[model samples]
Target chain A: MKKLINNPSDVVNEQLLGLAAAHPELHLSLAPRYVCRKDIPQGKVAVVSGGGSGHDPLHCGYVGFGMLDGACPGEIFTSPTPDQMYECAKHVDRGAGVLFIVKNYTGDVLNFETSAELCKMDGIQVQCILIDDDVAVKGGGHTSGRRGVGLTVLAEKIVGAAAQAGYSLGACADLCRRINQNGRSMGVALSSCIIPEAGETTFLLDNDEIELGIGIHGEQGVERRCMASVDILVELMVEHIFSDPEYVRVAREMNSASGEWEDVQLVSTPFSRGESFIVLVNGMGGTPPGELYGVYRKFAELCDEKGVSIKRNLVGTYISSLEMQGCSITMLRADDEMVRLWDARAVTPGLCFPSCDDVTSCGTSNAD
Target chain B: MLTKKNVLIWFEKSADAMAEHKQELHLLDAAIGDGDHGINMNRGFGKLALELPVMGAMTLQEIFKHAGMVLLSTVGGASGPLYGTLFLKGAATVGTSEALDASAVLTFFDAGVEGLVARGRTEENDKTMYDVWAPVLREYELCLEAEMEFVEILAACVCAAEVGMKATIPMLARKGRASYLGERSIGHQDPGATSSYYLINALYESIRE
Candidate 1:
């Protein structure tokens, strides 16, 4: 409850205004509340992703060169309405098409699906890819399957790069699905974060306990256990990600031919013994970078021990859940193409590459 | 008698009831959900309350459609689309009818539940509003088969909804945010189901008044 804000209801609005002011490359639309890249290239597939507001530097931070073309933020921990997404997509589409990258929560999935439908009705080609990389819950649960966490940032980066490279809408969507399938994430929370509107934490944990397999939102994790050392925690999380069975589930894909949703079964290939990985040691907001590096230190050692080569690694707060004190580890099986895409230069408010001089010359950026 | 005016009254009463129970719903949601069910529901209905004056001149189908559109635009969550779909699909069933008979009411409920099922992909035991709505539809059909009057059938449906809402207390959540709690989701009444019960009860009360 003790946070710096004027009012609980205006938190998202005020934060969005600040984000818009800070990031001049992004254009903010107030009526529908979406942020889009100001200088979008012509004839390139547009990449859009969004969800609740608490997971900052995610959909919005990824909205620049070689990443998201637009993002629609909703209320805290609530999915954005379809109208906002529809309007955002309409404005961002540059005559090629728009691809929606959605996390696999029920509200997000439902809202994104509705938005895609609306866009299609308005004569815009739309494709949606659902990200469900969290290893906490089994597939086909009473609720939606796994929640999309850190891997969402990875997907946005890779797919955004693909779109920037002039990949077709179908190609971008396929790459997104591949990234989603190859990634697995596991998280543990030392404490819960308070939601601004609720004025309380979603859950409580004792000083001696931690919740395992926690989602990005302040929701309870799959299990609770006595607190362990950082190395032990990293070992446990790495093992869970490595040992998870091949994920199989049914997802909705847009049937461009008939303009309806078609049921498509997707399978996530399990990690092999000698596969290479793009690893991310992500903080859940409250954790410091020093501690995150502590997680990566043990994580890298464990990967080396398991014969899994770390092709690339990002250790920081790429995605977060309010100010919850926790960290999640994401491992995406990376090939040469994925590694190359991961290294692509990007500039946004949340992520920036100072070495990249001109955004227009990079990739398929055409000055329009 | 279920006239167009009665339908408008039903919506007004439903909005009022949701506003009254807003805090209670938020408390229930705090236990297992993100704690915005009451806030979102009240916001949706509050918009409907504002539109009621303008909606008074529309046909039953138009009124329901307007209500659905308002909820879809104003309520920014899972319930927005789910409840909005319910009203939109229900409006489709009413077609050009000026008022509703028992059979027409049954048709509306059937379509509303179907829309909810299609949107949410929830089954009977998913611990959602479907649990309440499915029973209400079934009980209304039975009441209609017994040649009950429109108000009596509505009363019966409201009673069924109450029972269904209470039944959600011991059920494990299989859908929505509460499902993340797994077994811990049990013992708390579902906020969506509770709001649905109030909506149906408000319908009956509007007719009685």
Candidate 2:
């Protein structure tokens, strides 16, 4: 109930104002909450992505070089109304077509579609890419589909970089598809979050409780158990994600399919293997880096045990819940060309590729 | 048969019931939900009150249309869409006539249930609004099949709704936020289904009076 803020109701708007002030290089529409790069190229496709406001350093933080062209911010944990998204699309449109990057939530998908209609009315070429990377919720039903979480941030980064590098609009979109196909995320929550406006925790769990396979919005996880060791938690998550036959099958297929991959250890400027990938150990909210890194350590150990090579490893609070204590792990298999592109230099507040000297290869081999 | 006065009466009754249990509902939801069911429902129907007076001699559809708009705009959660769609679809079936006879009322209820299903993707055991609505809809059809008097039919549907609502207490949630609780959701009555029962009870009291 008690926190630092001018008003609970004005949180989103105030945060948006602060974000714009802090990141002067990013362009934000006064209304409709679109955050894009300051300068959008003419005749180049613009990528528009959005959702509710709680998950920071996402949707908006990624609105810089090599990421989203624009983002629409809605109320906390609530999908932006169709009106907001529609206006954002209209505002972010350059001569080139615009693609809507939407999460898989029903309301989000529907509202984005509504905005797409408005885009179409203006004769704007619009396509939609839905990110459904969470493995928590059972999928293939009329609903209860997987949620879009960490992978969304990855998609914006990779695809945004591709688009900026002069890939055709379709090619940029194809990169997005490849990212989604190769990526999967799963999370667990240690505690609940207090929504500022509501002045109460969204959900309550006992001191010994932990929720496995949780979503970013403080939604309950698929399973709850007594708090376990960090190693145990990572084991469960890694087992659930890696145990999927499809994930391995897909990785093997992508490994062979992405023929033009560069070997990082072999050469400084390797050609495209198109097989580089990323693993993000995302923090839900209240989790501290020390704790997050503790989990990441376990993740690295597991990947080593499994022989699943990581193209690049990113661990931090990239996507989050509303100050909830938890973390999600996402794995994205990249082709060698993709690995090259991932290595491509880009600058954003949240995402940064350190100098080559700063980076170190963790796994023993590409197979491992 | 519900005259305009009766429709207004239903809104008043539901509002009263919601006010009485608002805190309890909030508490129940706080356990495994976002903890705003009471406030959200209250805000939604509270707006329904102001519009009803000005909507003089409005038909069931018109009254429901107004309610739907209020719910959609004020509730601001999963309930917003579920309840809003219910009223919106209900309004689609009944026009702006000044009164609703028993059969017309049943038709509206049927439409509302359909809308709830379509919007929420909830099924019989999902521990949601559908829990209250499913049995009531079935009883309503049963009453019509038996050719019961309109009064009897209304009473039967309301009773069935109340039972269904109470039955949610022991049910494990399988939809929406509650489903995340898994087995932990077993003992708590679904907050959404509880409110839905209040709605049906309100309607029964108004029409009967």
TM-score of each: 0.94, 0.73
Q: Which candidate is the best by DockQ?
A: 1
Local accuracy of candidate 2 as per-residue lDDT tens digits, B110-204: 89888778656568887888988989988988898898977788789889988998888888776666665567788888888888888888887
- Model 1: per-residue lDDT, tens digit, B31-79? 8787788988999899899998899889889998898878887777788
Any runs in candidate 2 off by more than 4 Å, and if so which?
A: A23-52, A64-66, A69-132, A135-147, A159-178, A188-193, A197-240, A245-276, A286-305, A324-326, A336-368, B1-16, B50-66, B94-101, B144-152
**Candidate 1, pairs of clashing residues:** A142-B174, A143-B174
lDDT of 2 by residue, A325-356 (tens): 98999888767767667766556666655332
lDDT of 1 at A327: 97
Off by over 4 Å in 1: A353-368
Lowest-lDDT window of 10 residues in candidate 1 chain A? A354-363
DockQ of the two-chain complex in candidate 1: 0.68
Q: What is the interface RMSD of candidate 1, in Å?
A: 1.2
